[model samples]
Target: MAEVDLSVQRYSAEVIAHRHAHHQLVLPVEGALSLSVGGRELRAAGLSGVLVPGEARHAFAAPDPNRFLVIDVPLAAAESLGAAPWIERAAGGPIALDGAAALLVRAAAVELDAGGSAALRRQWAGLLVLTLAERAARAPGREPAKLGRALRYIEEHAHEPLTVAEVAARAELSPGHLHHLFRAVLGTTVQERVAELRLARATELLSRTDLGIAEIALRCGYADQSCLTRSLRRRHGVTPAALRRAARAARPAGPGRGGG
Candidate 1:
C-alpha cells in the first residue's frame, strides 16, 4: 500500500481546486475556510475543515492567510478505513475539533515537517484517523445498539482476556449474530475490533509506562511478548522496543516514576 502523505500548506485568499488523485483532508489551523463539493458549499472555522475525495470536484476559499494540515491519502486507502465515510459526512459541516484532535493534528503536522521516518508519519496518521472517528461518533444520532455494546465491551475488557464469544454474550446475541452485526454496521468483524482495542491499549502502555514488554502484553491480553510484538509491528510498522524508545524520548523530562 502507498503511504499517506501529510504536510502543511499556507493558503491566501483565493479559490483553489486540488486535482491530485487522492483523498484530502484540509484542517485549518488559523483562519476559516470554505469548501465547495458538487456545488455544495461548506464553511469551516479555524479548528475545522473539509474532506475531499479524489476526483470529487472540490474547491476551497479562504478569507485570509490560513494554515492547514493537508492530509493526502490514496482513495483506496481511505476506503479501507471503514470509518472514513463517517468522517466525510461529519465534514459536510464545520467540525469543531476539541483539544485532543487539535493536539494530534498539530503533532502530525510537526512530525511531517520534521522529515521523520515513514513509520512515524504513519503512526501520527493513525492517531489522526482515530481522533476523527471519535468526533464523528459523537456527532448526533445515537450509535447502533450492537455497535455501542461492542465498543463498551472492548473498552471494559481491553486489559483483560477477551473473546468474540464473550463480547457477544455481553450484547445478548450469539457469536455468529454478533459477527454479522459487526460486519454490516462497522464494516469489520468482532475479532478485528477486539484486536484493534487491544493494540490501542498496548500503545498507551508502551507510551505511558515503563512496564516490560512481556508484562504489557499479558496485561493487554496477549499470550506472550512475541505475540504482542508481532501484532504491534504489523499495525504500527515498528517494534515494541522502538515504540518504547520513541515514547521515552517524546515524554517530558522528569524523574523516574514508579507504577503504571
Candidate 2:
C-alpha cells in the first residue's frame, strides 16, 4: 500500500475547493462543515466528516473557523470502509464520528504533526482506519456477525499459522465467502491479516529476543527465513535484518533478554 499523509486543517467560513491526488478524509473537530463533491451536498455536524475519492472535485465551507483533521490516504485504504453498503451509499456523505472516533482522529493529527517517523505514522494510520471501520460497522442497518467473527479470529490466533481456509471454517463459511466478507468489512484479505499478525510478532521478537531470523520465522509460522523475509518486506517495506539492527540499537544495555 502507498503511504498516507495526515494533517489537521483549520478552515474559515469561506468555501474551499480543490482536487487531490489521493482520497481525502475531512473530519471536523468542532462546528459544522458542508461539502459539495461530484454534485452531492453533504453536511457534517458535531463529530463527523466526509470522504472524497482521489481526483474527485470537492468543495467545503464552515460556519466559522472550524478545526478538522485531513487524511490523504491511498485509494486502497478506503476499500475497507467501502465494503459496507451504508458507507458505499454514503460515499460522498459525511460520516458521523462519535466520541471514540473523534478522539482517534485528534490523536492521529497530533502524531502526524509531531514529525513522527514513518513507522509511527503507519501505526497511527492503522488505528485511525480501525476506528473508522468500527464506526462504519455500527451505522444503521449494518450486520455485525461476519465482521465480529473475523476480528475475533485474528486477535485469538495471531500467533498461529493462519490461512484463509482455516479462518473461513471458523466462521462456518467458504473461503470465497470469507474473502468477500473481509473485503467488505476490513478492506483486506485473511492472508493480509495473517501477514500483519506475523509481522507484529516479528517486531516484538526483534526488540526483545536473542533469537536468529530463522528461529523467529519458525516461531511466527513462516516456512523458513526467506518466507518470513518476503512477508515482512511486503507488509512493512523493511527487512528483518534491518529491523533487528534498529531494535538492538534502541534497546538499553542489559543482561536479561528474552523472546516470546
* Pairs of residues clashing in candidate 2: 80-187
Error of 1 at 111 (Å): 2.7
lDDT of 2 by residue, 1-260 (tens): 66655666665566778877676667755445678898887755444467776678888776443456666667665565453343345456555454456667777777766877778776666566556756556523433455445655765576676778888787777889778776665456777666655665676676557899999988877889999899878867889998888867866443321110
In candidate 1, position 194 carries an lDDT of 67
Tens digits of per-residue lDDT, candidate 1, 117-199, equal 86776666656766676555642343344545565566557667777889888877788877766655455676766676577
Alpha-carbon error at 103 in model 2, in Å?
1.6
RMSD of 1: 14.1
Candidate 2 accuracy as TM-score: 0.47
TM-score of each: 0.48, 0.47
Residue 113 accuracy (lDDT) in model 2: 66
Taken over the whole model, the C-alpha lDDT of each candidate is 0.65, 0.64
